[model samples]
Target chain A: MPYSETAREEQPRTPSLTIDALGKKCPIPIIWLAQRIGEVPLNAVVAVLADDPAAYTDVPAWCRLKSHPHVGTYELPEGGWSIHVRRNY
Target chain B: MLSAVEHSAVLHAAGVHERDGGAVSAVGVSRTGAVRVDAFAEAVAVPGTALACLQTANHEVGTLQPVAEVAAACREAGVPLLVDAAQTAGRLPLPEGWSVLTASAHKWGGPPGVGVLVVRKGTRFRSPLPEDEREGRRVPGFENVPAIVAAAAALRAGLAEEHEQERLSALVDRIRRTVPRVVPDVEVIGEDEDRAPHIVTFSCLYVAGEALLTELDKAGFAVSSGSSCTASTLRPSHVLEAMGVLTHGNIRVSLPRGASAADVDRFLEVLPGIVRRIRQEAGVSS
Candidate 1:
């Protein structure tokens, strides 16, 4: 099977959301998005962009507390980071 | 750390005069490694006659010794003042009218082993030892070229990130508020209005600093305890001692500009339990 077809067949179709919180420190990044994730459709993926070092530790911990699934984290060039979370009902 | 030349340039720019044959004084430094003061005070009996030296209260603690006042007193008494900017250099503004200033580069995010000392122009500073031909007859030995470049880069970077200081300050305030709410009887030191924004200190009533650090580390939190540095001796922090706060179970949390509020909050959430457990182990009540 092709890459897109394989991914589509493997995973459920969910809305994709991106939150740009670059340069925002700590709780603001997680807090802002956590508040907004409920507005997004259920089972949707929320991607958060942050530059703070503390976000790495905070985002995962926040996911644990809020019952969201922490999908993964990715590093960006030009000094930024991204955390992907899936909202569940 | 601002190097000797940079410090001297600042002094020269500020128009402070360094007197000849006077003691070298720095404000806000610990008694340990006070070679400049010791050298200046014992000049008459020792190898040379460089005069006055002074230091402020502990920098880690928010205790502001009367440095400027001491400088004024030294000026009236006819002595020179050298200030150590290790802990307070970037966070707090410098005290006015200091003839010489010194700092370490790594303390402010530059590379290590680079020390900065500034002497005012026309200040009579003679090298303690014989020197070759580097740093304009001031600092001897070959300088670490890359480290100096990195130090300048770090200084500029820190200055550019000045806006984040307020953010960190607010985060520190959150820690100050949240830590105590979570853990009762925990004394948070250096909450005075004059304290630096980047550092927060506290002591658990019934726990030891070492045990607290170990437990926190095991829980995946990196922090400094009074006993971390001097593990063998396990002596309490001199800063805490100077402030007359509880020294046994002290923890110093210094936040860099990159630390976030959520990280602080998570740490704060986990901290009370850690303290309680450590206290129980130490046979002290919460």
Candidate 2:
């Protein structure tokens, strides 16, 4: 088995997730956030951090399209943002 | 046009030392085709000085900088001016009051490695480094005689085509107007009233500049991004950063001489899909 597969199997299952998409531009942050959500168990909570100015629009749109429920969004003082998504499985 | 000896004599008469005081600073234009004056000012230490450095004759945004205004400023400050006419030297008449002008011959159909630097009478300049006995006191080293001859010939030929600039500028304007109509989520940069007439930049909302350039290259359109100078280090453009604009998925299109309307139309037709595909891959929507 690949090292990645072995590492995944050894890792403990968690209901909470974090996606650090800071410093990523545009669709990259949203796409990365979406992929991370896909890997979480049903009803899992995923938090995404993005620094792109467009993230205010992109993140919410992504949550809508992926059917993941948006928990909330908060603004970061350091010119970034945080979005919370709840995976619907 | 003075002969080689006359050119040397002119510099000598102007107190431009062949070895020491004949050097002029040069700066490279950004990928967006915009020239950054602050960088040049830093490099040459021209701040609050009488010395002026010229920007691209035609800016990357296709607008020409007010070289004459810069020259006037230098004059008011009692400083000489140097014009780096890389983008416009051979193609257009140089603005008045340019004391020293440098240009790459290849930009005007001449061979590479051949550069021309002209010093007007009474300009104070110095040679860059230690050197002796060469083409004038301004440039020291054995002359690439063949390249120089070719550059001169190319200059004359290019000057003959000055009339064509208006036509090409019009075509670029057309493309500038058409691109935004077709591509969504794009904000065209540098539409200032004083912008250049041959280059334009637009940033897609969700695409990365590198990915867009790669896709365009693969599709046979030679476009550029206003991002990093080299691959592997992905950073947004400093020009856009200065302007406080978004830098994602930026494309700078510089139309070469003789570029036709059909070519611009084709590029416009193909460009939106490229942006769309990249956005899709990145999972961004309009």
Candidate 3:
């Protein structure tokens, strides 16, 4: 639960909500993303930061499965990734 | 009863049977993909356990189960154990204390439609399905005699080339050792020492298994992958999941008898580039 609303300076895509789940395993980041997607306003970019290998492909897969638009993934300065998804109803 | 890492043939076979109030519990496997024999020992010692099943070696990862230990426990509890030796029928020696055994012919280059079933004397077995009232006999119906002969011949031939195990094990060890070194964000899975010789598995981070497999196939290497985004299954491989390893981007390489070291070397050479390309296409970097 390392989520935070950054001061719009951390990423290329400005995500209104960022769920930071660094160092977590597979499906946890996906689960957190699914659980919190409704919180953001419509068409807002919600970012989930996860390091598990499965999330690299599965986040896009979740979008394909749930019909959500995958905004794209961005590599962090350190390790892991910041996966972004647009909240589309 | 079954274990968490039994072959899907066993898992689905066990699953398809009609069960009414018959509780089935899957004994979990250790992190090394070996079945937790101590946990299994406790499960079988419980009274009223009908039958227990275990695979000879995992088909995905090459971890060999503690069949000898678990079989001793089953013997103590007076429960019958059925071993599915489809992966190791001709390749490895059968584990002792198995009351019954089953193997698929195609696994050892035999006819696809044939299977072998061996039920030891005095072991109680009643087919869950309604008995086919064709004939009163130990085995009924005309068997595929030609396919059966071919399967037997294949098994014998496969056994004769047992020396290949050493060469294959070396190659397997090579992959087990080299994959992680060559490919970044890769995890080589399964038991190193107590494993069957032919199989090796590894998972790559930030790559889809299907895309990697397709690219490998295009590069003229025949291999299998266990990933959720693939064709058939929508979930990651249960074996890798049970082992608690990286589930996606999984590749399982099974070296056939008389497999060439040069082919394996070529695979090792080409594999890193393929994984990198797949990662690039998936928009992932590791």
Could you estimate the TM-score for every candidate?
0.60, 0.66, 0.76
Chain A TM-score for model 3, please? 0.84
lDDT of 3 by residue, B58-124 (tens): 8888888888998999999999999889878887889998999999999898989898888899998
Instruction: Place model 1 in a CAPRI quality band.
Output: incorrect
Local error of candidate 1 at A36, Å? 54
i-RMS for every candidate: 19.1, 13.3, 10.2
Q: Write the per-residue lDDT of candidate 1 for residues B1-286, one digit (tens) a residue.
A: 1111112223333334334424332222222212222223333233332344433324444444445654565455455566766666665677875777777788678999887888987666766557778887777788899998998888778878867778887887888787878897666766444456777777665455667788888877777875334445533343443333445466778887699888898898888888877656644453
Best by DockQ: 2
State the lDDT of candidate 3 residue by residue for A35-76, as single tens digits. 788999998999889877566655665664466777777778
- What is candidate 1's TM-score for chain B alone? 0.77
lDDT of 2 by residue, B98-185 (tens): 7888788887789999977888878777776566766556677677899889989988886788666777678767766877798876
lDDT of 1 by residue, A17-82 (tens): 788889875435765665678777777788888886545545654564456777766677877776
Displacement of residue A47 (Cα, Å) in model 3 is 10
Model 1 chain B weakest 10-residue run by lDDT:
B1-10
